[model samples]
Target chain A: MQRSRLGDLTAFNQLVERYQGPVYNLALRMLSYEAAAEDVTQEVFLSAYRALGQYREGSFKAWLLTITANACRDLLRKRKRRQETSLEEMVETSGDRSVSPSPTPEEYTLRREVQREIQQALNHLSHDHRLAVLLVNLQGLDYGEAARAMGVSLGTLKSRLSRGRAQLREHLLTARGTREP
Target chain B: MFRRRSEPIRHQRVRELLSSYLDAQASERERELVERHVATCEACRRYQEELRDTVQAVRGLPQVTPPRTFTLAQAPRQRMAWALPSWGTPLATATAAALFAVLILGEVTGLIGSPVAHPTAMPSSEALSLKALVQPEAAPEPTPAASDALESLAVQDETPPAATQELSRSSADTSPPPPEEAAQPPLQVPLLPWLQGALGLLAVASGAWWLRRRRAIR
Candidate 1:
């Protein structure tokens, strides 16, 4: 971090290489779109690089993820401002509800179906709840780290996670029942 | 198990505990209590299992690799380049101050020579009155060209102490001008030098502070 702050491009790129996957995935899940997630991932790294001086010591990953979360939120706000529909609406409109070709293995098909259902269920969550779930459950940050990354208290994290999980479970179960037997 | 309906508050608390327990985030004692309660309680056990599955499903979502290396050759360097001007703010301010001091000094020494102070320039009515008061004996009805020239010179000379003394001498010869006109103090003091010195000090102080901040950041 010190090297990067001193304008070392190699050190900064090393940081980006290490974190790009998690950051990209976080954006993907939060946004439920590949292109938007890609843009946000780049934006997050660029913003992090410029703000390297302001970064304090702690979990670098948490700090990076914090930037990612805020960047995603800002993009979402911009999308909202364009008189565009909510993220859920975007997800629903772009979502693949069509059945896979039979030539594909049934197991792979089922897996893809489940993935889509999970994404749709995630889309139903409010932005905060979705972000909490993405950070803690998907990104594997513990509650404390996730709370810090989300800039919320631990108690608030727990509440959002609990509510988010309950809603997700309900949606998944309902979706599964409708699709499967 | 049927008695669980009578303890709604306890049921809610246990449900919250179960949610945390599934994440392995519950306190040790809370974990123990949740474990014990779920063991005896069918509803709580089912709720815990469902939450656990939900978490697993989310975790099972495959991680996607970024479509491309979100890397750039010179973006950060470009940002640094843009920021270079921000660091030059103090230097710019100091340069501006120096230029302002030069202008003021030139104005004070009449080196830059304001057009308003030229002898051939037209004099306002007030300048004519002051000129009449300063040089009462020169002309009661001087020619237009001479009066205009004399008024201009008188206005230009009005900045010096010698000019004020000359006015006092001329007023002594007259029946004494109105008190308001007499009470007017000379508009010029050694203000230009004082202003130039203050500006120089400010420029030095600003440059020093900027250097100190740059050192601290380094």
Candidate 2:
């Protein structure tokens, strides 16, 4: 962090390489689109690079994820304003929906199907709930760290996480039942 | 009464604590309490199962590698770009202040003449008349015979004879005699423009130095 603040490009790039997966994953889950997630991931790093001076001592991962969340919210707002669509509508209309490649075509199809279902369920949640789930469940941050990232109280974070998980469970179960029948 | 009103809140709090307990995020005491409560509470037990499943499903989602390296180059250029606004704001303000000072100096030194000053160009004649109007003691006294003659002329003209004669006599006595004092040029301070210019140059130089130091550090 000290070297990065002192304008060392190598140090900053090292930090970026270490955290890009988690940042991109957070963006992916928050946005539900591959291309938008990629764009937001890049933006998050660039913004973090510029604001390196303001970085304080703590979990660098939490700080970077906070930036990712804010960037995703901004893009979501822009998408909302442009199309006046709800989160569900935006998810449904998303372009270039793809997952990381699997070894077998059949496995890839199944994995993509499950990912799409989860993404849809995630999109069904309110922004706060979705963020809480992504930070805690997806990004693997603890309750306190997730709360810090979301800028909410610990109780609020737990509430949102609980609600978000319940909603996701309901949707995933319903989807499974429909497919099986 | 208060406990009755807060009963629902307490129940919700317990449920949330139980949710945390399922995730292993609750304290030992809270975990024991939640465990005890969930054993008896059918709805909470169901909620706990749902939360567990939700977390499991989320964790089961695929994590993807980044498509490409997000490594950044052009460190100096990017740093400069960010530095622009931080350095630019105060420099812009200083430039504005310098321009304002120059404009004021220009007006003061008559390089940019004012409208009020233009009307007062023939200062000698205007000054003499103002002096005469303002100094009644300097005027000569009116003669008795002259006042009597003017009174007769006013009566023939059928005006307020005595009052008209007194006003005429006073005007004639107080009318300024010309060409007594020579016109003097207004005072000019030679140091003013030089001082303003030096100050403006100093501000610009300091601002440039500050920006240069910022760029070098980056």
Candidate 3:
């Protein structure tokens, strides 16, 4: 970090510990594979360490997410080569997998269906569009931060999200065999 | 189908501020603009809801807590800050400086000569050496004072011959001032040039030295 105050490993580690969940979550959604997401997350932190000196004030998180996004992209390219994605190998990380005392069978089935569709829709997207959708819609980043995280201008962020969301909508609709809006 | 009204295809250019904005990244202006547009624009509003659903779906993605936090405190790769010890830099700088001075002073003074010469001692050869070590020694220092007024006059005035002739004439016309005084003027004449040349060289060398020191500090 440019600030000498955060120059030590302790501070850097703190950042890793604090933001890892969100960063990993974002990567998981974009990459759609548990292992690849974790790998990308590690690569992102490694990159963040290498680029720590270049870190400017007030943009640390944006800078970090940008790295995370790029790492996701690289993994995607590597995945294309194998033609066998590691998606099925992913350990199910259902946050709410524990039996609920008051869950109706319908709700459980609906959630399971939604999860499958979400994963399918995300995988269907281009990296740019997937990342745009993940950061803005799920990660709750604004256009500017998402744009920054994606290392794009605000316009590009909007375009990707627009296209990405549209694609996602189409995928969800088709999966449900519902009429297109 | 979406239709164009007189309102002119009014829709938020941003259907939804992407998911990252949820973490408080948007400027107030952006939040307000998106808020207002989503309120009035059905297309953007619907997109916002869908965007929300999509993001929520992703969030609900199975959380794969890797068996370990992959980033376990693998000792941080050594950084330049750590690789370069605090004291090591100053030592390196000092060694570099010593080498730089040796090389430069060598070129100027024909190598292995006296490291520095006094201004009033012998300035003629010293000034030439400056143009010689110009690369390392061009930094100028404030001149303490003019070293030799007479030598300066000699080089600047182009009257060395006339000065010599006058000295000869004075010797022939009058009895030399007492031995004590006779030795004084002659001694003073040579020193004037030596002083001037020395001062100039010192000024040039000091300036160069100052710059080197400054750069080392950085």
DockQ per model, Cα? 0.28, 0.31, 0.15
lDDT to native, each model: 0.73, 0.71, 0.59
Residue-level lDDT tens digits of model 1 in B1-218: 35544566766778877768887889999888788888898988888888899989998887776778876577564443435354466566667567677766766875543322334332354555666554454334444565455456656775645444444344444455556444444334344566757766776775665564332222
Q: Flag regions of model 2 displaced more than 4 Å.
A: A84-108, B1-14, B76-218
Winner by TM-score between candidate 2 and candidate 1: 1
Query: Over the stretch B1-218, how does candidate 2's per-residue lDDT look in tens digits?
Result: 34453645655767768667777888889888788777887877787777687777788777766677777875635543545455565776678567667657777766543222233444354444433443344455545665565556556776644435445555465454333322334334354666767766766765676664433222
- lDDT, residue B106, candidate 2: 70
Error of 2 at B199 (Å): 22
Question: Per-residue lDDT for A1-181 in model 3, tens only?
Answer: 4342345666667778767777787787776666777787787776566556555555566667777776776676787787874654453445453233435889877766677677777778888888887776666676777776666788777667767776887787687775234
Where is the poorest 10-residue window by lDDT in model 3 chain A?
Answer: A91-100
Best by lDDT: 1
Which is the better candidate, 2 or 3, if ranked by DockQ?
2
C-alpha TM-score for every candidate: 0.61, 0.60, 0.50
Clashes of 2: 0
TM-score of chain B of each: 0.35, 0.34, 0.32
Better of 1 and 2 by DockQ: 2
All-Cα superposition RMSD per candidate: 13.0, 12.3, 14.7
Candidate 2 lDDT over residue span A15-108, tens digit each? 9999998998888788877678889988888878877765666789998998888888888889888886555554531212334444587776
* Angstrom error at residue A133, model 1: 1.1
